[model samples]
Target: HQRLLCEIFNEICIPDLRSNINVDRILTLRRQVDALKIHRETFEKDLNELEDKHIDKKRKFLELNEKFHNEYAD
Candidate 1:
């Protein structure tokens, strides 16, 4: 009788164990999103540094060009 009751409960209620499966999938997606966010922030920081260096180089080049013209024009 006990075995029969266990079988009946499983037949009626056990197939919806999918909720746990979906929870695992949701957690995995959340972890992926966090990893992508970290990558984006790192890329942004590196890009900003490169842009700053480019601006500094441009400024130095202009200053040298102006000084050369002033000394040679006379």
Candidate 2:
């Protein structure tokens, strides 16, 4: 009877311990995901700003090129 009780206790407690570990892992993964999301947003914003600057510079360059060609046209 004592051995049977011990077996029953072990069966119940082991699964609870395993579930707790799984929950901890899930929480850690969720925190990592949140951090990655923030980083991705920051990177995307920086990329967009760089792209806008590049477009503006390209437009200015094209305008200058056109003006030079028009002034020197024979």
Candidate 3:
């Protein structure tokens, strides 16, 4: 009976414990990492857009200053 129980446990329980429990934990971590990557990408895109807008505004300001200086001869 002891040998039979050992055989049964080796066949069923160990495989279930190793495969199901570990796989669940690994998959959960993978999902969280993927979500974090997406969140980081969104922030990077927003920062790039803000930088582009700032450059555009600065260019316009400089161009207006040049125009006024040329027109008034100052």
Which candidate comes out best when scored by lDDT?
Answer: 1
lDDT of 1 by residue, 14-72 (tens): 55665566778899999999999999999999999999999999999999999999999
Error of 3 at 69 (Å): 1.3
* Candidate 2 lDDT tens digits, 1-74: 99998897775644455455567889999999999999999999999999999999999999999999999995
**Local distance difference test values of all predictions, in order:** 0.91, 0.90, 0.90
Cα RMSDs, all models: 9.0, 6.7, 7.8
What does candidate 3 score on TM? 0.63
Cα shift from native, residue 34, model 1 (Å): 0.5
Each candidate structure's TM-score, on Cα atoms with residue i matched to residue i, is 0.69, 0.68, 0.63
For model 1, where is the 10-residue window of minimal lDDT? 11-20
Best-matching candidate per TM-score: 1
Pitting candidate 2 against candidate 3, the one with the higher TM-score is 2
lDDT tens readout by residue for model 3, 1-74? 99988887785644455455667889999999999999999999999999999999999999999999999996
Clashing pairs in 3: none
